[model samples]
Target: MNVEGRTIEEDAVSAPPPDLSEWALHAFCLGARSSPHPVVAMDDNGRILYYAVGGIDMDRLMELGLKPNESQLALMKAYRLLTVEDGRLTTSFPVVGPQVMGELRRDIRAISADVTQSIRRDSEEMCAELARRGHAHHGYAVVFGHAVDGLVWEQLRDQLPSTKLSLERPFWNGAFWAIHPRRDDAAGVNEHPWSEGTLVSVWSARIAFELRSFLTESAVGRLTHNADGVLPVIHSDDSDELHRHGKLIAERLAEAILCDPRSKALSERIVGTHPGESLLIFAHELIWDLMDCLVEATPLVRPRALDNGSAPASDLRQLLFIRQ
Candidate 1:
């Protein structure tokens, strides 16, 4: 967790060996969004049980090169610079473990409000679009871990008076809610997961939302009860070497974004000037927190078991558990 990172200056002299830990962390965070194929976490039975969720089609967009519009270009550049490879596994070890949790926990706690606001913007836009179609008046979900509760929502509602909050569930572990603009006529709480928060408020709201979307929306897979979480093996051979080269390339690009004046200017144009460097740093931090959260969650066996079984078994459970 505390591995020494290659300095930006070192990047200029010569590329260093791939930091497998760093690469794994990046893959854990951004694999779904950036890769063409599914990025899965493996269970003890060698079954791929968890799939990452992604909003954009990076490979398709990346292929557009200079053909995309300005906004698309900016987003593509950000994705290219920030994420590792799409379909490949980058580390030799399972990302989940107690040995690395301390570092991850600290990183999670440091997520910022700016990042939360950015994430909220995306969710709100989606909700607004849904409303336009008359599909639903409003939809709300929160991104949170087991340790967080509705208090976070309460505080956020207090802060953003434009939005109203109503709890659909009273439980602390996974509180669901319905939220919308105070002036909007949306009503009723329904089954959904649009709320967002992080444990100890350590992870940013944006990353938390992204992770929540992945866990709830993607194909459901179970974590093996006994194994340390396993990362998918996309390639039996040359994966480690490919990862090293990829890591080197990614680091150099990140460094160039910070160091080269031309690259810096391009980033400013793409990302805007208000918070500037702070915003970029926040993005970086959010990605790291995301990786940490994914790894931490992948080994838990209980969440994997919650999927409603196939139709026949679904009714059987109701019949078995309830008296006539």
Candidate 2:
């Protein structure tokens, strides 16, 4: 089947291979003792089906040819990221190929300039409030970023058209991208105590690869180690932080509208509900223009994190994804 002017066969041929070195570096930073092999599965027609890790059975594969183990498949299914339909193992989530990505990038960039401005205003206000409250720690910034995601979800979920396809809990809750590290058995591997950590970025499913590339190229955020893992922090003093932060927020908002099921439903509903209107223009209106109306009537505050006498920074750090 053709998608976004490209055939599935073309996508299979054009899709870049997963970067092993990048994954290895990420795993190493996470203090993983071992790393799982990343896997990509496709159908006979060259339609990409799954992008995952740790479903391969090397013992059975080397002996009897390559195949996924039944036990591992079952576990994936349990997570709702994979499914068995008509005796075939299939991906349960959406995957966007290069063609669609190109189209989305073109469409998004057209309105991203304005959207970035709106996001910058809001973020500045948020940052200013944090500073006034003496809560301008990087941890609070991270938490507020995620809280924005949740706020967006809550506002748009009910307005969106409903779909029968159920999303995985992690995806539904906006925590789909996660890093699982193996235990670090080797001692004295890390010279600095805070150097041992993992960096994770959260976004919708389809644009996972693209978003990673964007973050890498843009250098939007920096990683800081904590007891749990590494968190990406954007410092206010950095000259380009606001510009990059605004752009990153705009890109993530576009990803949600185009790729996330719930937000995509809203986009579809908007397009269908209003005929003879440009999707990009209307989307910009619905999101950026109406930002104030969409915001919660009552402002949200994490009292415990703010009130905690000891280790408020640590508390805020832990609060990043705790609500999810």
Candidate 3:
């Protein structure tokens, strides 16, 4: 009996025969690779279709709530319309019938709907906060995001009361609103540049704290009176603390850019301005040198460009490097 069973199993386990057309085998191979977890292809009419289960362990099938017999049943159901070709089951036929295909598509669409709603909620909240801040500061708001999210927010922006959305600087404390999507859009980031917009206008509630902490730890009494009132000015001689302060500022700046959905674009811009591997170090050095020029001057000056080989004025220049 054992010898007979072994013969039967061996008979069942054969490579897809050559007589089957190339396209049929190709379709089966494609279905095997693309389907989810257990990889059971179904037909359009919800019929069970072909499955490649040759080497799959019995335990693995059990994990998917299948027994050896059930797995065979499911596969047979999927391939119910199959006709033998040259002593082999034809594989080129689609595993999924029309009915099952429609169900799977519907399921995917339902999932997409839920995700869209969640992202819309997040975008709305960010915009609402920007509108509130703009109203309080008597300024307009700037909304940005991945290309798709930006469009969605723009559509929703007009609904915001007393809010004007502009890509250019409107000479007000512009509230920065970024729409975060469920998935990171890498291509969009590489395409856009943050410097193209009024990056100087990015107003974060955390900026005040970051500025004070940088001043207290690095500059101490190096504070000077400027149009922005008493603020940390200029770089002293190179020291560990100054480097650390620069790193801190760079990290914060990086976070602001990355969180804004145009992080890759801004990174490209920063690289254009100060080309280097370690952006944190570049930002640190840049901040240190720029501040030195500002703080060391007898009378305060708003630097339009760096004496060193750095790019001309930017919001980062206006907000962090220079005193208000």
Candidate 4:
């Protein structure tokens, strides 16, 4: 038999393709160099991504279980989508494996359905905890205490003209009752303890163990805070831990926003911060980040504005350093 020499029938000795892991990683890294958005590389593991926040709502602080030596960088996710064009790379969100991604996606769907109820439970607990402290804190983007809501892509772009995201209003938080998967479609949850919401607020929310960045920064001064139209989304290493304390904080904040008075006055602020549209953008960017981490292949990717047939969908998106 030619087995030892690696020869067999026409299709019998079809050895598997060379393990593309190394080259894949290299090519992907190079291609992804163009953009900085985290990506989800490809994986046979069936990873999952659960988007919790989008638009302008708070932050994207995902607690990957807690680590002691950790700085803010420890908790941040690195998943992102990649594109290679004209010998260059670009990125989307961060990346995750298929299993993780699937689990998160399903988990989020399940959570979203009963978000209002979940938030209420969280609120009660948060209030009790805050009471124990004798004083409560607040946030800035208080829409009746809803905390945060995403503006339309155009509106958000207008508000924060210096930011970039592959999709429209890409934010997710565990506190975000809006996008948490409602159905039983979620496959699993990670031991790391995932938090959902916009990446902005949470990334820098943690400052100290006893004292966190969220309580100090995102929290409104209640009667003392008053700002309109513009929302603050500052990024820093601290974002990764914003959810470590627990999802209860997010729930409490969301509930407060939904029922607050000063926030109710936001009739003409955001234009149209709907549900379905924003979620799609959130999911797309998140998923792309996952793929970015898992898969590795270089196809003459290119950068361009808008998704056009000009050079294939993926290539066009990767190269888009600027879009009108």
Candidate 5:
């Protein structure tokens, strides 16, 4: 909490949800601690099931103009920015709600329980798997994808040594996900919708752990699955292959940049130049390869923050390396 516009973390343990509607969101929760990165449950149609912890509280935080503090942990169940610190976690989405108050109640119970269970799962099965493979990384859950799985996440943990991931799930007011518990229903579609897009958002974070603090940040992307809304399960054996596959995706994107009929125009618009921008286009699309290679990814991006705010773009200016 801030008193006189100054940090008074002296009593953070005693801090309750801000009585105010505003909130102060933080950066991505890279694996530096043992808590669930808030999760967002969505149905087959891609609408949110409920705010596991609640995004409105976060909107309120932003209204107060507090930037994301990588060292702080007081946050809501949002994937807007995946980061955790000081035992707190924050993720985000829009203010798209009339979110059933009862659903919020259930989510509170489930989220609390799952966060702990998730942490334990990581330390137990997930961490050991990494050690066995001579790898080093432990991932947490996100507000996307199917139920957070311990073994499945080990692959990503190994690939991104300095990474933390989260899986989202929401409890409906009085409904159950027809696909699985972790995946909730979308906005308009009932939890039992037929033939809708069954997809999950995959939020990836890269962390720089400091002595008393950790710097966490990530990009959000999607992975769409079948009609039942059940995300296809990717077990361990398929993990290494997925990493190589992402590289292949990167290569394909480079070719697409050269061959796509509108590639030249799109390149010019994005970089404000034409001839020298091919690499930029390739790099931009390579971000897709980065996404594809990940165990999961969000299929879409929310337009703007609920507060009409914008995220700080990573310094991609240096990612423009051209192939010799």
Candidate 6:
């Protein structure tokens, strides 16, 4: 029989069957790759969409008391993170399994430790200089403490190896709040915490503790209720009241860190077992404590004004509007 212009026997001899070696290699590569971590992504509007990972399903979510509405499912489908194939839910994304995650976590810890130490030392020096300049020391603790948290991420982010993981900084508002989600159980599906904005890391627990202290005890937070009317309706205004609020927040933060059991346990664990996990938390507390000690040891002098300029109130208000 003839096939196209060539006889069947001629075509067979010329093109022979392609070997399976290349196909076998491709299959092996796919099998050897690590699986991606299952995570839920949240948009600015607070809507969350899940990235399907193995063993997580609607039944599991229901068992855990979670009820994702139809709108959420529709949003997930829109983002292509969810799909129905043959009446089965399926999704695809890059993966890094538990073992790879552990290794990456270790690397992150090591780099974060070095960066945090350097920042702490710099913060201490800056506080000392401020004290020498006869600036009021009351607000330096919270200022430097919060600054250290941001600096740690800024410095460590570039040093760590890239992965598909999401690393978010502790949430903070310019005027008052510093928010963080509590840690979830390590072995569970983690949909609950994921929904609540918790990242997968031991450091998240530390961030939660630190932010909770600020939220509850800081003078700038809701506890003070507009700094007892000293602050303007616009919280971020650059006024004397804002400075006073900052000073009060610093003083309250210092006291809170020393008295909070969570902070104490973290400090104790720094010299106890698993120091690596507690290093950042301990460093954070130590920075605040050291600043407080510096304020107490040095005599207070007349304070000079520092630059506290910020975005215009109108511009800041625009952030509240949701962009379509």
TM-scores for all predictions: 0.21, 0.38, 0.16, 0.19, 0.20, 0.28
For model 6, which pairs clash?
Answer: 35-95, 35-96, 36-95, 36-96
**How close to the true structure is residue 63 of candidate 5, measured as C-alpha lDDT?**
45
Model 4, 213-264: lDDT tens per residue? 2223343232113233123221212232212112343434334334443323
Model 2 spans > 4 angstroms off: 1-13, 18-65, 135-147, 159-324
Ranking by TM-score: 2, 6, 1, 5, 4, 3
Residue-wise lDDT of candidate 2 within 1-324, one digit each (tens)? 232244424544564333221211111112222222232122210112222222223453334333555666655555444566554544443333344333443444434444445455545554555455444543233323333333343334443333222433322211111111111110111111223322333322233334444445223223332233333333323253433443445455655555555434333432212221223323433342223322222132332432333333344343332111
Model 3 superposed RMSD (Cα): 24.8
Model 1 stretches with alpha carbons more than 4 Å out: 1-91, 137-324
Question: What is the per-residue lDDT of model 5 for residues 1-324, given as tens digits with 9 covering 90 to 100?
Answer: 332122323454533232222221111123323322232211111111122223224444444553434323222323232334443333222111112222333333332232333233223343244335432221111111211221222322322222334354221111111111111111010011114332222222121112002111211112122223222222323254322332333334334444544444443333212243233322323232332223222222221211122222221111111010
- Per-residue accuracy of model 6 over 214-318 as CA lDDT, tens digit each: 333332233224333321221223253333333443444434344455454544432212332233334343443343343444342111211112333322211
CA deviation > 4 Å runs, candidate 6: 1-51, 54-72, 78-88, 91-97, 116-120, 127-324
Which has the better TM-score: candidate 2, or candidate 6? 2
Q: What's the distance in Å from true for residue 231, model 4?
A: 23
TM-score of model 3 relative to the true fold?
0.16
Q: lDDT per prediction?
A: 0.25, 0.34, 0.26, 0.24, 0.26, 0.30
Task: Count backbone overlaps in model 4.
Answer: 96
Q: Give the TM-score of candidate 2.
A: 0.38
Quality of model 3 by C-alpha lDDT:
0.26
**Model 4: residues with Cα > 4 Å off, grouped in runs:** 1-82, 85-113, 138-324
Residue 128 in model 5: lDDT: 43
Q: What would you estimate as the lDDT of candidate 6? A: 0.30
lDDT per residue for candidate 3 within 1-324, as digits (tens), equals 111012212443332221111111111111121222122232211111222211233454345454435454445434322333332332222222223223333333333333333333333433344345332111111111121212232332332222222333122111111111111111010111122221112222224334333444224232232344322222222342322233333333334323433323333432212222222222222222322332233122322222222332332223332111
- Candidate 6, residue 64: how far the Cα is off, in Å: 14
Model 4, TM vs. native = 0.19
